[model samples]
Target: MATQIVTSEANTAAVPGEALEFDDIQGLVFFGHGHLKYSRYVFLRMKDGKQARARAWLRTLLERKEVSTASGKQHPGLKDVKGEHALQVAFTYSGLKALGLSPEVMTTFLQEFREGMRDERRARILGDTGGSAPEKWQVGGDATMAHVVLVLFGKDDADLDVFHASHRDCYQEALEEVFIQDADMRQGDTEPFGFRDGISFPYIKGVPTTRGSDALGLPINAGEFILGYHNAYGQYPFSPRVPRSQDPGNLLPDVPRSQRVSGEPRPKDLGRNGTYLVIRKLRQDVAGFWKFVEENSRDPDKSAEENEANKELLAAKLVGRWRSGAPVELCPMKDDPTLGADSARNNHFEFRDDPYGVKCPLSSHVRRSNPRDTLVDDPQESIKLGSRHLIIRRGRPYHDKFADGAEEQGLMFVALNTNIGRQFEFIQQTWMNNPKFSDLYDSKDPIAGDNYDPEYPGDEPKDYTAVVPGFPVRQRLTGLPRFVHTRGGDYFFLPGIKALRYLSMERTP
Candidate 1:
């Protein structure tokens, strides 16, 4: 049975929309679970010929109500509800196939999800070359592919330990552990690079949470993040489905009437209220990043304080925001801790006024990731165009020193989108990795872009540059090194609650 529909006051007043099925949607879609500081991503591969055991394990999780949902009371000033622990399950293409999904139904999924993140063509487009190549990836590569990923979150390390241990043996017969990635929220939500993170998120219509000014006066359509609804393009995004015969138990929702083909039987919605998850393990070179900034900004003639200020400015221009999360576009002259901490004013500004990129450089990390009102001559038109590519980020920074005396510290870059190609890949390839973004001749995103790779030959320039627009003449900072490197990543489909139940059901002969 479907959960009772509940309309939100925010959705009712903001947009004329139908009630959202919070009970069916996963909690991670709405909440980052910031309060739960400890997180573990356990990657597993289904045991060969253990489809029945795997289905039984999923049924156990659903029956125990271990999976988190978005039905709880909303928190004040934040989108998440108070929780001691959160558990989310997602499946790779291989995982779905292991569960015995028919080939015809599998073909209905997005091509990007089918090919995966480590596909050779995808790796090239994602700039995963040189040290960041898929062959060098520690996980989610061809040899280390994971069929399933269990996202576990807890309020503390003890809580996480207990939660993980409790379920450790539940799927032992059905799955084999491939790898584990653990992450914790740093103080003040800063990443290893010492900058505030998780500052931007799209306000989904009918979500029933206060986004304040973060939405930038535009709430994205629910279908942009969730399937089975109308997207910003005024059409339903392609979602995988199953024939009615396959779902004899009626564990899934029916395909909407408008979406049904004239003579075809009504199929079951396998992707309703679900979304795609893109997870990338990005390793940041903290020492190298500061060293480059210090080396480039040093001036013997200037006082130590003046030199320090110059260094901070250069680093801020590269990141497009001060260390405290205040966008340079809002305060170009100096760092404003007050404005950075103010949620109402921090993300409320636009780049239209700084058209020349004097404040925030066109090639800066934030600017490239989200051009925001600077894509076209008309600011409103640009915002509308940009809205289509928006993604909800729900990642956390990780730090760990392995037993081999190697240190690993970076961000577990996680994002949710209905269309991985149009949203995530488009931003990664067309905006961040593209050297010609914002009309710059040879500049990529200063902080996170794949600037150059000697091993892989392409149109990428040999040298990297960070351009800063100025009054007398624009200053170009050259000889930049790759600051962020991709370690491992993959695309997974986060199914809805009912879909999980449906997937767990045995097919009728």
Candidate 2:
């Protein structure tokens, strides 16, 4: 998450509530201290309105979701109620009831969470959240909320006692208070692998595309990442496109207008309004990563002056951004705290600006992952690529530093789109993990690669490295281990708010 120091003003503006219903819910389980657990549920609304279709999806979900123990038994039983085509996976959380009702049972917990946020606001007011002005952070809060995100971890562990109190404990305490009624809620972080998780996500196709609005950085069409499908009114509004024969289930069209793909000439009775969802649980290796970074960046025989500069440069390239969180495109020569902190300028560059690896290596992680303006040499090509490559990264970092350190600590990368196959995976397999884009398959996402060698750490000889022909001969940064590791993940469809009411009716399968 970009550190934006926002002002502490409650939303006094009376805005209408957005319809927040989905066909399925994908929940991630985070286990920690004192058997504490954290979970995040991503709600998906499907694009179709056929009750049978919704029911079909639920059956498939239950059938495929069985987990057998060593002795072959399970805890949660699968039950099916009709009017299907929606999917939701409920994971463990401590605070479900506290989210809405029963103030007496949860007032104190809610109050504490409120205090934590207020504390953050006060810090912002006192100039602590990092930006010089509120505008520098830019992104809005309501735009950030899409799924249920929670965090939970204990503070007394030997390793955690240090930074836990200093850095992470605040977030943990805030979440606990906010979701106090649900004792099952836990804090959610990035996948433990720590790949700057949630870099690329699919944009919904067809719906109007909002590149950089007041709320979210970019409001892409929902179709681009949901089912690898686009909505019927591509690049247009959805309110006017609904069929005349249908009723708006339990959802109000006046609320958030969620439309399904309905451009094809279909019968008038068809209903449209839903989307898809994908859930994943990825693990990160924090201890091993720090160990590797420390070991590889140092040279045994080289003088400190000779080695230190190269070491720092390589680290910067590996992450594609400086430690200050500034994208290398703008601050090519070095990290610029001012630029990194500027929302208008920080994320606004393509690696093409720095062709020679001077400010940023051609193979920098962020550049390679998001070529941005790099792919197109021509101005028109660059513009086209910008529209296609854009994605909304809505996720946060999760770390239980004091836990056994054997597992769990990273990002919970969440993205919503109409098409999943093309956008999200393309960024992962084609851009981030792909090597051909680099020099002769020499560079990939150093932080996300599965195959790693314990040996060979250092910079490639300048003469040996080659990204271009006769001019810009770049050296490759070697010895860095992949930072993000994928343990497991799955894809599910999130139906719309209207479809949700349709399913609540409970028909026989």
Candidate 3:
């Protein structure tokens, strides 16, 4: 028998007049499934003239309860649920069209999602030039575009394989496989770069958890992540809708009154409880990263142990955290494995005390990613401004070895947000890829930025220069090579359970 688990709705603090409907949301939004160590992502393209069959297969899966929801019981925290697994499905703009959604309804989605991550202009903004260009992508490229992505999680490889094979058999006739990406958490919370990742995440206002305030010191608005709610800007994030006449089966919920203009027709909400999902396959060069650090940290006069310490310090400065996930601002002298392991203390520090980036560089990966109090003079104001651009990250690391004996390993990056342009894309363009970030001179994110894109336009700096602040003088590390490259990526729409059913419904003739 399945273990009975309480829903988050019963445990979380309710919003003033409205409570989050956890049952309508996908489990990925609530939990990372860390207990399920193995994962597989299968990308599919629907077969020509097989829209009906695809929809039928989707309806069958929904009926069988294959797709997981945000229930505390179904969460990985529970133990010994037999054949326990998680299955999530998302679609691209092409996928929705392939499923027969009307053009009128499709236009309502965010333009960034409609144009996709591979659009020429977007690629430039995201620094997808040189080796990271879309043409070089293994999947989600022109020749390998996919319509749908099936995300599965399992306790082990065998469990994942069994689940994947079963689902693959069900949808094979309606959809053809485009690519298969597999990931595992064998690194135990550390990314391929040998630093603890996934250490920071935004806490939604209506989500119940024992964890305290996020690094920003408060819970962000639910509408920032989920549709049909108020965002940080005090307005509903735009969501797609279908005409009332089209939803004849009444499979979808009515659009909230606040979201509708007085003169417009009241449509059925297709994006309620749904959020946009961003997927990126980043290839991390572990050997290249370490080699660069080792070469740059060398000093003939220094002792071997001292050189090693310098190397470690340089790496930490680049990432803004020690190898064990401790923020360098708290323990800059050395690694504190114990402190890093403590969730309460590790993320509590702010950059205001070390304004000059003496402890953590202004251009460091973590600092640039989330500037916290440093964005403005007033810490509280900075927090409010930063909240508008937060994203809920759910990425995992993957390792694969090719037949030629070459090893490939990196992160299967996943992020969820309501507005792609305002949240995810803003972070990429304004923070990660900006050479002028924090007024730094010709520096991009040392770990993940597109620092050396040869095909980039204009006279932008082609090489990255890391700035490390010190008392008397600042240290500059130049000639840094690109450490991470984007292999494949795309924007997808992860619909609510009701929207899923609505998508599976046929239109009235």
Candidate 4:
């Protein structure tokens, strides 16, 4: 019932430092299937001191991992191509330690990875405050010990059998195969709340992200999402290194002591070809979300027909995009499927023209997630500044009907970035979670914000006011409800093939 993601078998297993093997890196990072019907997230914990076993399993899995350019005339097993699935992997801070990573390399990891998403400082800044602190996370305290994430893709359960048949025994023996989470792809590209997604991804060089040179968005530097390249700061982000004795063969890139960026200097290259990864299990209240919009869209003077139409329009104002995925910037008052489906046009619009919240509201999800050219006066400056905060988000919805067929369903939100501070967390904290964003006061991300703050009376949540010009009175929805909540997630590092091999073969000092 799900669409299958296909790849070629001509993947290169290169050990070259700068040349990244698209095949060795997870396929999910670069590909998405609107028809992908089945997805399984296999969580893992390292067995006690079984480094040898973990490495053995990893080496074998890496050989089979899907590569980037695997299409056209390829392996015989992928005849249908659409029916095949792919598997990719990454490791958390504790997971890396469990695999025998030493303190020296550990110290070189990002603060978010080393300290985790549960860091008290980050919790408060990102609106994870009050009775439900970071400690309330599903994987809190000692439970942050998740080591490996096995991202499995398939059209259905049957497709995954190939993966299990090949590595099940080794996975069980070498590492603890924690519970596997299967993401629901029932609504196609839409989330459970019924909104189309994955529509606007930034085009990056060398990754094969966009189809044409004239794609709506501008192409960004690969370093924005990958390590070892010039980042948004025009400087290479800090890469980890170890003593030459720890990696005598120089399988990794070496940096002299004076070449250090910020952290303490080391000789061996452990941080090269690696990127920071963020994962969050967000639970959504689909019914409550629609109900709130319906109730709030009502007006005594408006006729029933007018109020009925206002339901979707009001929701669009909050989301900054119609359920059809057509951006409100382009179709301010209507839904256009043809435009939404057109890759050439969907992401072509910007917010600089509609500055006064005439079309997309200031607090809308799109504006909050990506302010675009609206954040600054000069369009060129806004584009330049905004590009610095871009992040590659990869999320899949999960749905499991309850006995009443009303169970909780949400998305497995995943993000890729080199600097969690400047890229991912900055957007979440400074933009999405911020109550006052972009010169607007008391407004926040209407769809994904945690508006509850004890700083307000009755610990009551604040409202998101939407302004549509020429309408005279603005539409304000009071008694705002939190439509999404974080259940669990972690920060991990997706090492390059060479770095992954190091994890498998070398025992760092």
Off by over 4 Å in 4: 1-24, 33-35, 64-83, 130-132, 161-166, 211-217, 255-266, 300-304, 402-406, 453-458, 462-472, 506-509
Query: Against the unseen true structure, what C-alpha lDDT does each candidate score?
Result: 0.85, 0.36, 0.85, 0.69
Off by over 4 Å in 2: 1-274, 300-310, 400-407, 453-474, 477-480
> Global lDDT for candidate 2?
0.36
Task: Report the CA-based lDDT of candidate 4 relative to the real structure.
Answer: 0.69
Worst 10 residues of 4 by lDDT: 68-77
How many pairs of residues collide in model 3? 1
- Write candidate 3's Cα lDDT for 1-509 as tens digits: 12234534324442242377777788888777777889998999999989999999999988987887775445532222233789899999999998999988899999999999899998988888888889999998888889999999999898899999999889999999999999889779889989998878776766655443555576788999999888998888999999887888888888888888687678999999899999999999899899988887778999999999988988999899999999999988799999888877788878888887999999899998888887889988988888998999999999988999989999999999999999999998999989898878699899988875545454344366888876124778887678899999899999988999999987532
- lDDT string for model 4 (359-434, tens) is 8888889888988877778876777788889888888998756698667788888888888888888998899877
TM-score of each: 0.94, 0.51, 0.94, 0.86
Q: Write the per-residue lDDT of candidate 1 for residues 445-495, one digit (tens) a residue.
A: 878898755555553444688888761247787866788899999999999
Tens-place lDDT per residue, model 2, 108-205, is 12121223211344223222122212222211122221122322232223322342333223222223211111111133222333322332322232
Candidate 2 displacement at residue 101 in angstroms: 31
Sorted by TM-score (best first), the order is 1, 3, 4, 2
How good is model 2 by TM-score? 0.51
